[model samples]
Target: MHVIIFSWEYPPRVVGQLAEYVRLLAAELVKNRVDVHVVTYHDFLTGAVEEPDGVKVFRVANPVRTHVGILTWALTLNQEVERAAASIYYQVGKQVALVDVHDWHFIPAAVTLKNAFGLPFAYSVESLEDHRAPPANTPYSMSIKSIEWLGFYEAQRVCVKSEWMRDEIVRIHAVPKGKITVVKPKANSWIRDILAMYKSMAGGAGKN
Candidate 1:
């Protein structure tokens, strides 16, 4: 199956565990003989394409930095996502079966692809609104909440990392129970061993 994954982060530019999870997931998908292409924002401003672990990764420019306010920033991010999705959809041809998005931030890209090519898009909701603490008066939080609702409405299947998120989406967003799927993160043994080695080295250094 040709799968186009849209994520906000990926390996070598990790903001959190999601990037690592995406890298591992894409690698596993490739091993299973699936053609995976990932599109993410290039933090270092490098427009480069590379194949890592049989999965193609495309890093594009983030156009949201020009926005001075939080709302505009979110809008610009969605705009860049639309632009990138268009390019990927055109290049990948019309045989693509699925457009899988890693988070709500990549919803615009998934929606764009689905709308353009009439494909089914699935969403992996790593976090849900009820899972997080109550929002403050900050504009960032407000903007996120508003845009996230659109993602929920757009996804054909909403995959959650935890049971809590699955229930939260069903109860809070009123998404049908049939539309949600609970999938846990698969651990990569090689990556775990490498982390253990790094931790051991750090511990030895701390003792010195």
Candidate 2:
């Protein structure tokens, strides 16, 4: 099965756990012999299309020149996502079975991909209610809520990390309970090995 993943960030440009999660999931999917393609922001350094962990990673340039605010950035990200997804469709020429969007930040991108290819898409709500939380009077918050609502309506499945998030989206956002699935996040074993190696190196240096 061909799966296209959309995330705002991915390694080696780690912003948060989302990037790590994407990396881990992609690796697992690759291990299972699934053809996976990831579309994300261009790496600031290489700017080259490369396969990381057996998954094809495509990076697109962010078009927005200035970071006016969160809302503007979100809108621009969506625009870039649409452009990237279209490019992927044209180049790949194979319809994706599923498009997995990481978080609310990638909702616009996911929606664009879904619309452009008419493919089934799933959403992963990494940070729940953070966008809707207090100082909610801002235009950015409203825009986020609107985008999230659209995503909720469009996605075939709403995947979340915890039951709290699933419940919140169902309760506050009025998303159907049946539409939500709670899948707990698992730490990547490769990352654990890397951390252990770093710790060992630090210990050896300390002994020296």
Candidate 3:
């Protein structure tokens, strides 16, 4: 099985746990003979593509713009991810097995990829725009929230770290109550949860 993962950060570009989590997940998947491809941002000195531990990683450059807000940068980053992914999808001569996308940071590209390839994407929601208390409804904030809504609505699966986040997803995005999987962050359980999520996603795809 193959999974194309999208994230804003990865090893050597460590934004948070997301980067480290993805690194561990990809390495473990490779050991299990699963083809894991990561699409992320290129940090200061890393090349566009890195093949660490047999996990194929494509990093797109997302340089900061002087006047543009973070959303604009995110959109531009999505374009880079999409272009690289399209190239790989054609070169491999196989449809991507599943799209494992992380948050709204990469939703623009993930949505396009899913629609273009007719694949179901599993969204990992780390946080939500609406759950961030006051000023969370500002223009930029609301825009990101809408993107999150679209992600939940379009996803075949949703994974979250805590029940609070799961509730936030259901309440804020209006996703079905039973659709979210709660995965703990402990090292041992996280991998099992991810594997189960992948199986669920793959099984759903088969039904389609």
Candidate 4:
């Protein structure tokens, strides 16, 4: 099956541990014969490249260079992200099976793709604004929370690293327990569990 992964960071763009985590997951998926494509952000680099391990990486840069906060920055960059992902969709003959979003940064783009192209997406919950920010009810934090809520509501599935995170998501977003799956990345069953998640969603709706 073919899949697209959305992340804000990748190799040579490490802002946090999620970058390496996604890198390893994509590589594992490739080893199992899955067509893995990653769409991510870069300051100056803007294009696609095939990695040595057979993963296709598409890097997009934010067109507007200035922003007041993460919200504006992410919102502006999503246009570019959506453009790149759409290009991949048509370039691959519209065979993209699933989109795995690593965090909240790209939820808008993913949701747009889902609505416009019938592509199913999964939200890989790495962190949450409710947990990250000191005051969660601020307008800015609420905006982020709203995006998280939208993602959970739209995704075919929600994958978390632990039971704690799954519980957290349920508590924060009111997401149904059945909609969330606890799959620890790189564990013994990591590949098997993740493959099952992908296969399950891959057979769902997509552009016809």
Number of the top-ranking candidate, with lDDT as the measure: 4
Model 2, C-alpha of 198: deviation from truth (Å): 35
Which residue ranges in model 3 land beyond 4 Å of their true spot?
43-50, 63-67, 132-135, 187-189, 206-208
lDDT of 4 by residue, 55-117 (tens): 999999998989999999999999999999999999999999989999899999999999999
In model 1, state the lDDT of residue 96: 62
Worst 10 residues of 2 by lDDT: 199-208
> What lDDT does each candidate get?
0.67, 0.70, 0.79, 0.93
Can you give the TM-score per candidate against the true fold? 0.79, 0.81, 0.89, 0.97
**Which residue pairs clash in candidate 2?**
none
The digit string of per-residue lDDT tens for model 2 on 102-179 reads 877778777766666566677778775444476555676777777788888998778777788888888768999988
Clashing pairs in 4: none
| lDDT at 58, model 1 | 74
The lowest-lDDT stretch of 10 consecutive residues in candidate 4 is 199-208
By lDDT, is 3 or 4 better? Answer: 4
lDDT (C-alpha) at residue 46 in model 3 = 34
Give lDDT for model 3.
Answer: 0.79
